[model samples]
Target: MDKVDIQASNANILKDHGSDNKLNVSYGGPKIGRYVSASSNISTGYLLLSESPVGSVLYKDKCGSHCVYCFSRLVAGYPCEACCDVAFCSPICRKKKKASFHQFECRYQEFLTGLGISSIGRLALRLITSKPFDYFLKIRKYLNDTNETLESNRSLITRNLDVIQFNAHEVYEFVRKDNQNLKPSKQIAIGLAIYQRASYMNHSCKGEPIFDNYGPTFYFKETKDRQKELKDRYWFNCNCQACQENWSLLNDLISIPKESLSYNKKLKQDSFKDLIHFIESNYVDGKMPTESIVRAIDKFRTVCYNMGSVHYLNK
Candidate 1:
């Protein structure tokens, strides 16, 4: 079938099955992929994919004052009278969370706290309790029907369970351990949430569009990483451009020579303004050229670097 026909068929099937129209799970470039792109013509750098959490959990010790539902940090929040440990930014979030998943977990809060299970494990538990067994059966059937090779294993349910059990590990953040110590110790994981579509994103130490979480909506950025942590924990080698080229090679490719352009204040100001406007306009709600956007951003950074303004590049 033609690409248009195939997409139409897929959409019809999803609509028939009562799937959320916002989510599109299909087979393509990377086996089974979740995408926000409706067509190949759509530009890159657009906020393409987004999914609400299937399950989420807050850290028992950390984020105590943050809303259990939205993860909003509140100076003062509406406390859960039953658990005493949880709080919400507003009554609406509290009500929604309780109706959706918190009702199942509220009574077991103490037990979960004592178990010291990783956030993924707790999220898994929440998933099981919040969703009916028939839900997974439907998901499995849908996946099989889609003919996506990403989940070709016969024991799909078992594999998902295994992912929850083994793949989920504790995440740590650097924090001051003691007042006297100049160096910081790694603090324990503060929170975690599972998004079915979000999990499908492949790893890249230098993957384009960098992923960042604001509440539940994730946005992308470009940065450098060794992928050592992801490899050790998630067990995958990233093949993204940054990973493949390494920082030195990638830098060389995008860098502008110092002699090419003299540091003209007007040129610098205009270029920066144009680049920022283009990104904000094209990358926010509409489609964008993924490679082109990345290159433009990199070139802008290179220009700033060549002008001997290292700090301005990040800003």
Candidate 2:
């Protein structure tokens, strides 16, 4: 999919707990669920969640010219005087981040960069440094109320620190593997972030909401991931519609003739936009038979692959 610059999108969509909003975080067993607000009726491609970053870390190698705070790419950025690795889009963002997490992280830049810590590890540090002990206590209390336990012994801060360390491995495996260009040191810094509400989302190969990150902000879209990756990283057996009915099963059910199913079929205009339009207009939104929908998706995937547009599969 096209990398969404979430920084440029509608800002209000990420606001917390707005009355007219389409997204709401609700309790559902061990995990939290982000659902469409009772009053909202979202269409097939609608965005279901937008979360602002509570804490974030930049990939050291890939983000030299990107703003360390907002993550906006810049031809040239104002470098942090304290650490050569960090830069920012504006003075305000730099100052704000510094006052929060960077002050502590700045001192350990060399060690952090050298150790090649995973992004989640960096995020755990950021969480500990940015928020106070009391903050963690409040969070612990809130979690405990929901039947979740964040055990700690000496103090709330220590307890929360332990919790972060424990959960880092789980979070680390889920880090996206798409940034192949990152050098070893930079790879350690690969995008890591935490948004309070966004963390609770459950796994689904055909998850209705997909998120794109631009710095600390995430833009949500309706879309779909691999079952093995989800289970391996997130520790859940996916029962999403796409996983339950494997693509092979769907492919067999297509009512369209074999000739029509061929990707080599001639089109008046063979272009990505045209193919997408054809599929959406003809098969999306349950407008066609189930088999036809499956066929259209298969055709779309084939066209995308042939055109070197495999990114579309993620959307």
Candidate 3:
């Protein structure tokens, strides 16, 4: 692989090193497996990842409950006619699943769970199945080469293992704690998603968690010790202004009506359309769409309201 002179378009924006634990392929990257950084000349609206998420899958716990294909919550979900183990949100999802990967993995559903596949194991399996047969052939041939060094093989395996599991993030961001019908006792991770670009983003105590559409993620937790919860789950200290100054969760809380809250969120969603349109129209190659990008980020200002959507607070 190293002998090939191929270069990715995102070479400047992203660097993939062999592994964080065993290799420092990305020069000067801290705690590195992969890192993303935009070049100074890049524009603000420059897209980093055109399309991503190498792969994902529904966790065994969510199998019967969520769509085996799209991982959406089942609403009169369409079942795999052949097996009772999985269902889909729509016939389209079911068909797509069957056409792509599910058809191949269906027979194994009976015992893969019994084999006790961990979160990483499931995603690894997804990674394998998501690829074309030729892709595996290429990898297998490389790994099996008689002249291949053990150190190279070990390095590649270590890197793949970390990227597949350690950096994998939960995805249940939309399934708010109180929003679903069939409630879990606590925050439930419905699936897993790997947004490699965002791995380079630093977590701020006040920042909203980033999630992709592919897999499971967490939502609610006791808000009593916000900082502690942040530390335990996210590995960050909540030294943001709220925690440093000891702000109250309900201090002078303005009680926005449930209807208004929903409306505002919708408005926020619409503003994104406007922002995207403006960037598409006004942005010129090599020039930053500074104003539009700022508008996009500012749209999240109201997300603080999610702290307790009236429905969840009332519950």
Candidate 4:
């Protein structure tokens, strides 16, 4: 199948919140329904959750960049004063994340308590407050009701807390930094989360490393990986076709070149379909083995560095 077909499939899976979305389940008596916590370490509690040993590492890197559609951004609209230093779900996760984003804003806990916000809400408040002052300036205009709005906002924050804190920077700088040795795909995944949270990066039709589903899990891999790496993988996890056409659309936003972008600004923008055709026809090497495919994937890394909406967007 082509990239569009693959991405639409992935997006649908997430919207449905299938089994993969239910990472943890507590068993109860057969008579009683199992209490499922949508807010957990694995599910990311409206906040971007990371797998790094340091709690919420991805969160810290992208804390300053806020996307309009981001869960954290909406939650941040409320002041999460109570749970500034606490994790949203469990005490253990709270303790693990104590030193993360909390250290800087923990003192603001009173903001939550006085406002009747929950611990989770408090954390969200802390995150927004920690952002550039401009964020608050933008919020102030939309705040509407101070007393009622703040109260309701606080209520939402306290629910669905994570076990880990958002502090991933202090895990030792060396440890927190990206591991260069990881497979390129894994590294891009980490970067993707970071940019998604911080920058309003755009997508491209000619993008590489499309996001796809291998049955239960979501993945962003080089197009060439389709034959070798993705052979056994299922195709339903992805719903974003743009993602299927070019996973690097995100990475390029982070790595684009200063000059090429200016030149691209003057050139005609490529349509998604056109880009998809270009990538399939010009980039692919059917005769070469895995190494050749890998090489082409690496070459496309420059796409991230190219100047275009795919690399940088404010909203």
lDDT, candidate 4, 125-225, per-residue tens: 44544355566687786556444424555445543233112211221111112222212221121111121111111111222221112312112344445
The C-alpha TM-scores of every prediction are: 0.53, 0.55, 0.52, 0.25
Q: How would you encode candidate 3's per-residue C-alpha lDDT over 149-217 as one tens digit per residue?
A: 466656665565566644676655233345433122234567776655556443111222212222211
Q: Which stretches of candidate 1 lie over 4 Å from their true place?
A: 1-38, 41-44, 132-190, 203-227, 249-255, 258-273, 276-315
lDDT against the true structure, each candidate:
0.50, 0.49, 0.50, 0.31
Q: Write down the lDDT that model 4 would get.
A: 0.31
Q: Which digits, one per residue and each the tens of the lDDT, describe model 2 over residues 1-315?
A: 244343343334436532235543333333533332323444333434545666776666646856767766555677787888788888888888787778878889889878987666677677778876567777775553543455555566455444443233211111222333111111123355665544434311132443322111001111124555555555555554444544434434436544454333343323555555545554533433357655445555444333321111121
lDDT of 2 at 188: 22
lDDT of 2 at 303: 41
Runs of candidate 2 exceeding 4 Å displacement: 1-26, 30-40, 132-190, 203-225, 249-281, 284-315
Ranking by lDDT: 3, 1, 2, 4
State the lDDT at 181 in candidate 3: 30
Give me the candidate number with maximum TM-score.
Answer: 2
Number of the candidate with higher TM-score, 1 or 3? 1
